[model samples]
Target: MKKSLIALAVLAASGASFAQSSVQIDGIMDAGFQSIDYKGNKVNGIGNNGSATSQINFRGTEDLGGGLKANFRVETDWNTVSNKGNTGSASTPVVAGNETVAAASTFGNGEIRAGLAGGFGAIDAGVVNYNTLGTYLTGQPFGTAIGSGFRTFYVNDAQSTSQVRSDNSVKYTSPSFNGFNASLYYAAKQTKAVDTANTVTNSVTTAYGVKQTSFGGLGAYDMQGTTEVGVNYANGPLAASFSSLKQDFKDVGTGTTDQTVNTLGANYAFGDAKLFGLYQTNKTNTSSVNNKAFSISGTYTMGAVVLMAQAGELKNDVNSTKSKLVALGADYNLSKRTAVYFRAESIDDKAGTVQAALTPATIKGADTKFARTAIGIRHAF
Candidate 1:
């Protein structure tokens, strides 16, 4: 009789523990028609991510004893227009967050993460991303990926390049205290390339970016694996973020050098409107070249409608290069998770010379320019 009672008690405890865990699946379905004019060349067609990036996500959490918890997340990039996947770029094999880099395949793999949280904060291993930092940065006052996205999408070389999703990476986020929180990420390694035997050489060109190899092959670089730090504060209507990122490539020889990027971002809310700004700089430890970029953006809300505008500039120190952009858009909310959006953006390479095929292929080459407009509907579920 005592054995039976003890068995029932154990089963009840197990049931209670299971009850504390939960799992959910959520995603965004976004599609639109876009009309783009690439330096007088025009194309109008169905598009993906009109107002946002379309992706699917699965996440779950389990409550543990003593202020500790276990959590996991997996996500993928999708294109509603072509029903394609996002096969991230050569530089970043798997992208998980707001991106400032390039894309190689039509549909790239996004982020997969698992972690633990407690009084010390949280730690996530894998592609530690929660996505669309670009979406967050661009949306600012009024949230949409298309309108104020010119600053993030159009510029090729900018100081604050978007976050490069790392393959073998881990991140730690501290608990917020006094409206301040910080995050640190250590990107361990890169996904294997098609040509795994390619030695880190000086000036070896890859599908992603040109390698600057020289000096007895003493230097190597890989933009994928790096260390990143971000600090943020929010007290009420005002918020700000500061970040530092460093990229290092493994060495085939000796004296391998790397590069660094630093950024500052801020925003303020005033009644029906909000202001946003960002500035960034990139400096190479081995080279004399440096890059800088900045943007000012805002959004206004009225009833069920939101309006947005943003402008930015990129100055490349390599060859007196300059790129400028402007973007605008509007959105009408049908509900909290459903909306219709429209946006227009333009970019100009003021240097009047296309550099090369490096940035987004849509505006490849030097002295090239383009304008884009998109209208679509978005639903989150």
Candidate 2:
């Protein structure tokens, strides 16, 4: 849920006149108690976002006339109890469940971008998700839907800084036509590849009067740029999306392999239920390392109540191992802006899914299966 407060005013740019220049503040706070059981151990505690992730954000727009507009957005989530920025990731040292409320890492900016939009389409540059995977995801069971999201899923495993989002990126979105649209994104690899440029080195004088040079590019990775393209169709009760993404690196393990991924997915709606499915494949050109995943999910909405379920499988062809996930949950809305939900999910691990490396220390072990249940409240403002 969100609220927008608008203040109208006239504005002129590029010798053109327009009206309605304003800004708005919006955010959501979701928290609740969650429980988890890994193998034979069960742990419970009060955390946050049992139903959704908590976040705060601000966005505004200035009409630039001639069907053009200027816009900016900055969003960051909070740790709530600490009243500080929230850290979306859990570092190995910060996984103690019994740690004090203020022990968690500080919050961080989620996305910040500024861009222009017009009859042709829209363009934005900043920390952004440059991939069009969302178009195909539709009602993805992952994300904030309690037990519906499977962490081992491939769609959530792409971690190349620019996979789903990047620190610096430019994205272009085409205007919709007949329920058809397209998007393209490019994220520059921030690295000084060897003798890259003047912006990568510094000079200092040694005590012996000898000129010393210090290069700040060592260990810098992700040298090549990243590119993503996506197309989607949402007509009537059917919606589908397709995307191809390529991540470039200076040297891909032994001077071989190019990391590339492709995904296709669709969603169909009928009555009070919607069906969603996605398939993805990722490969390294010069290596036998590859990953593939398939997922199916569904949601049912009855007035202010909602139910969700999901199942997925991820396979690592290189190791001939796989992981399976299943989840189910339900949500009840107290009002248009607030809700409560209960969710439970489990991951049946066969071979370790690399994505599970970040699992909290409290839940890390030689467990063949992981499970959890949670109840939470979410309110948007």
Candidate 3:
């Protein structure tokens, strides 16, 4: 009887170990309340409102013989507040007037993977978080929660398309060596054609020989490509990284060309305090203008209270316009995964042609002066 009991116990233990070695699910959910002051008018309300902006990810590994392993990850963004009218909705509408789907899968070697993840070295390709490069270098506070601070100087003239998260991409990453790693990625544009004649409102009506039938053809350009490269070195209290990106679009026969972007950033840490800075420039052969931007930020922690501050400047060479921004924030950490934060920001437009714009906020109307203050709580799980 004693031997039988021991054997049962051992089998149970073995089963538990095998179960632990199988796949696991883990992710984070971030949400907060934000306010904006566009040209002195204050608009305050619950934002991202009850939506978690959450992600569910699964990870597993199959150990092969001879120290080899097959690893995989499948991730997808979820709209936790889909039932709520104001929550889980996109901050902005897409070109197709529909919500975007965030789903990605990666299968490859251990830490060194060659699959769909985010962008290449610094960018994100498939369904991942922000591109590694932007997240590492620019460190823009509003890139995640909000869609601001993701553009060059002149391109942000209060009227430009915001940065977009990539989709349908393949990426490769090298194993980290001494806290250093590199990555690369490519995204495929699955285009389609549309016939406006059947979709038009007035189909069978014609008076002045105006052709109501129109056809638009869309197809992926094989010659077009997006490239990203980045390198980083980190040791103890000091870390730095640099990255660059270039996007080439197939000629649409309208004399419009593709775009290119360059960015550099550095950060130094001392005890509980750190200083970060970044400079980015954007150019295009289609236009005779160039945009440049620079920003510096400082963050310090004191027990449960953390203080943060940042200043930025943007300039346009063709228009000789410039804009300046300043921000200060504080956070009280309730625990490792939860915190309460307060932030205040101000923007001053020095450009005679451009208006003052706020970071992380929109300039919907046409007013110039903008300032905002907000206090919110964020929890990551």
The number of residue pairs in model 3 that clash at the backbone is 10
Per-candidate TM equals: 0.76, 0.79, 0.68
Q: Highest TM-score, which number?
A: 2
Model 3 worst lDDT run, 10 consecutive residues: 97-106
| Model 2 CA deviation exceeding 4 Å by range | 5-19, 38-41, 81-108, 142-145, 160-163, 193-224, 252-257, 354-358, 361-363
Per-residue lDDT over 105-176 for candidate 1, one digit per residue giving the tens place of the 0 to 100 score: 232256778999999999998766522233245225434355543334332122234443655578898999
In angstroms, the error of model 3 at 131 is 4.3
Tens digit per residue, CA lDDT, model 2, 1-381: 455655444433322333357678888887788786665567788767666657788888887678999998877657654444345444222111111112133333566789999998999987666444474356465463455443455543234222345545788989999999999988765333332222222564223111111212223332345688888888999988888887665342223335677777788999999898878887777646587878899999999989988888888888898878788888899998888888888887775552443256566656667777888887888
Which 10 consecutive positions of candidate 1 have the poorest summed lDDT?
211-220
TM-score of 2: 0.79
Model 2: colliding residue pairs: 85-107, 86-107, 257-286
Best prediction by lDDT: 2
Q: What is the lDDT of candidate 2?
A: 0.64
What local distance difference test score does each model get?
0.62, 0.64, 0.49
Candidate 3 lDDT, 155-220, residue by residue in tens: 311113323333345555665688887656554433232312222235654231111121112232
Candidate 1 segments whose C-alpha is farther than 4 A from its true place: 1-15, 84-108, 130-144, 149-163, 189-224, 250-257, 351-367
Candidate 2 shows a clash count of 3
Q: Rank by TM-score, descending? A: 2, 1, 3
